[model samples]
Target: MASSNWISGIVVCTLIASCLFVVAGIIGIVLGPHILQSQVEKQLPLTADSDQLDSWSTPPVPIYLQFWLWECVNVGEVLRGAKPYVVQRGPFTYLEHRTKTGVYFNDNYTVTYRQPISYTFVPEKSALPETTRITMVNTPIVTIVALLRNQSAKTQEIFNIVKNFFNETLFIDHTAREWIWGYEDPLLKAAKSLPIIKDLVPDDHFGYFYGSNATDDGLYTVFTGEDHINQLNNINKWNGISSLPYWRTPWGNQINGTDGSWFPPLIGKDLQSIRLYLYSTDICRSLYAKFEKHSSVLDIPTELFSIPAEIFLNSTLNPDNIAFGTTDSGVLDVSVCRQGAPIYISLPHLLYAADRYQSRLEGIEPDAPIHRTIFEVEPHTGLVLSAQKRLQINVFLQPEHFIDDFKYISEVVLPAIWINESTTIDQKSADDLNNQVLRFFTIVRWVSIVLIPIGIVIFIVTIVLFKKHRSREESTPLLFAEANNTIASDHDH
Candidate 1:
């Protein structure tokens, strides 16, 4: 009886252990995905306590700013009614740094921040010095002329008087620094006195990227993802406004995207079908990036997204896109957004643009491999693994019927400078992602996979052992009765 009880106890213990393991396996299989997703979501929000907040405010990734300037070579011949001959210049490279300041957490699951960015010249990366001269259009003179295109003839006459006073030529020699930073001109010196030119320039000097260093873009209110994880990093408001007044249509004005720096965790969502939105404060507009191909960074699986070339197409060729003008078939008019400046934007080397515009220039080359904007995002984490935003700045040097210098100058889209701002994840961040997130996910997955099969095997063994124990007890009952009777008789005698 003692031996039977021992065997029975072992069987019961085995059955209980198998039952517990099966329950654990079922729970893991059912709830594992949710737990992992929760963990990922926790790390994404921009809360003060979160580790990712520091990465967003002060990114560890190195950002590079590269420029290729276009120089008008035959300025004398171009002034005599000939198409301008152009030459492409060096990649004047700079290392850019950014920091977020004046952080304020809002009550409605959003945080506001002011970002200041600066750039430093990198000699090893640059092809030319800051003092390298570029022969290009006299931008202030051309800008004033284009600004007065819609003004009354009386207003034009007043501007003509100012132009004569400045005596600025259509084409002039300026250093790379002057073209990139700010250069003083006589007409812009009186910009305060002239109402027409006042809004176009921030100060007496005007350069493409001159006055932007160490300046905060604006107040940005971004989602913290407390309520919904997908909404993380999305700009709820920019400069106290939910939308911009720069573009022509309502759809164009919506400020619905992240700050182009960080993306929320995607987890198990469909990446290929989803469209990523990026809001660039510099452009005062949001661009949608569509999945182009499968890519990888730091050996992490990623999806490559690019701004659709359709966005660059004009109204007629791409009728669905109403953000740009109907006439300029290949340009993005950032004039209204840029304080009434006649600033036309395009892809570097006139890439993804109308062929006619590219054909109009002598040295401009529109190659996709070299110039397209690229964003490599890790699919599961939604982190920007690597990114390159390339753009070209062009000037509309149209012939004005009223101006004598422009009479010989034909209507042409002139390329001034092209820029490429790019960044990639550092190895340390990649290693952290692997250790913290990817390793946890792997362990959870293996637990579910191993536990289910092991639980089933243990259950099958328990059932077989239970049946054998029952059979042995049933067969021994008769033999055990006879033995018990013999023992009782002996005791009576």
Candidate 2:
């Protein structure tokens, strides 16, 4: 009985408190507009491009899809006034999966007799051409290359970088040098043998080398289209091709777009440096205290897919902390140090200048990340870090067979790649922060609104009960007084 009575008392008090809260909340609701207005009126810049870095382009190019497994750091889709960039063609668009070969060359033939052709092309194949062409309309894709060169000095360090370029992982080497692997006939003896074709190579060199087929006696020329002349002409404009001799393969005549001659670009020179913008990729393993599979923010992976110098050293950071600060001054710059060992650094602003040169050659518009980050780097550095490091941007272009270059185009080919790319935006730390703040305020406002009405009802009930009890008590007193007065009058008579 005592417990029940205590519970009843608690319930009554809670109801009364709730009623008061509801009333207060009703008043707060009326002031909500003012609060909302204040927040809305606060100004925020959409795109920070006051101090913009100009970009470069190369022209007459055969379009090869670049697949960037980017872990976006900021709200690219929102700021660009559209949905985030995705691989529309989906996953595996750039993976060439081939099952059959019309013919293959045999090395068993004697000097007087030419090599016999076999029915199969050797090496493990990825995505086949017909398969990729079928799904070409579904995903967003970009062409990517494995950068393999030293842009700093013309020393054996270049060979070390080249040998390790596509080793077990990908890393950005800033020493300036020409480099390439998987050339058709005249294979490089070492990374040192790469030709110095271009005169204006950047101190911090950047380029990419990629091939679809792999083999011993030089891989077959896997050309995909008949526009070889146009593709060849376009590559020449970028000044990124090889000066090595070309050898004709019997299979070259059999290739669908057979020109019977192949000239691949110097590994670093055949690529557009502007295309080396930093993108977030899934880390094979976490190295930092904050890094985890579930964590949102991710640093560039030097051990995964190859990232060029233009993208690596493209931002500025606070001196005390190497965190990216502002790109307004120039391309964001960074000193890549592991346990205090400085590896390589780049100035995206300088790359942006190089981008301008390349853009003039290519007709395609530069992507959003390219224009925004590179442009912001200049202003941020110009005002604060005047004595900052500056790196040059070099362009590398390779004349990949139409089908060969297209393998990396995740946009038109891979659905899985597209899904992964799409999911990258929601996983960013900034998005997580914004979402958490929004949820907290939303819950608070809703709970306060709900309590206001209950508080008002309790307050009303308490006032009514008190007034009724007081009125009844006063009536009894009045009745007693009247009766006493009547008795007194009778006695006097």
Q: What TM-score should be assigned to candidate 2?
A: 0.28
TM per prediction: 0.84, 0.28
What is the lDDT of every predicted structure here?
A: 0.81, 0.26
Error of 1 at 241 (Å): 0.7
Model 1: lowest-lDDT 10 consecutive positions: 320-329
- True-structure Cα RMSD, model 2: 24.5
Give per-residue CA lDDT, model 2, range 85-140, as digits (tens): 32222112222122222222223210011111111221232132212222111010
lDDT of 1 by residue, 1-493 (tens): 8987888888788877877777787777778867877777776777878887787888888999998889999888788778778888889998988989988888999999998989899989999998999999887878777777888878777777777777767888889988897788767778657776576455677889877888877888999888888898899998899978777788888987787666776556676777788887656678888888888888877788888787777787777567655545667777776656677788887787776676666777788877888898875567898999888888877777777578788777889999999999999989988897777767877887788778778879978978988897898888899999999999999
Give lDDT for model 2. 0.26
- Stretches of candidate 2 off by over 4 Å are 1-185, 189-359, 367-449, 479-493
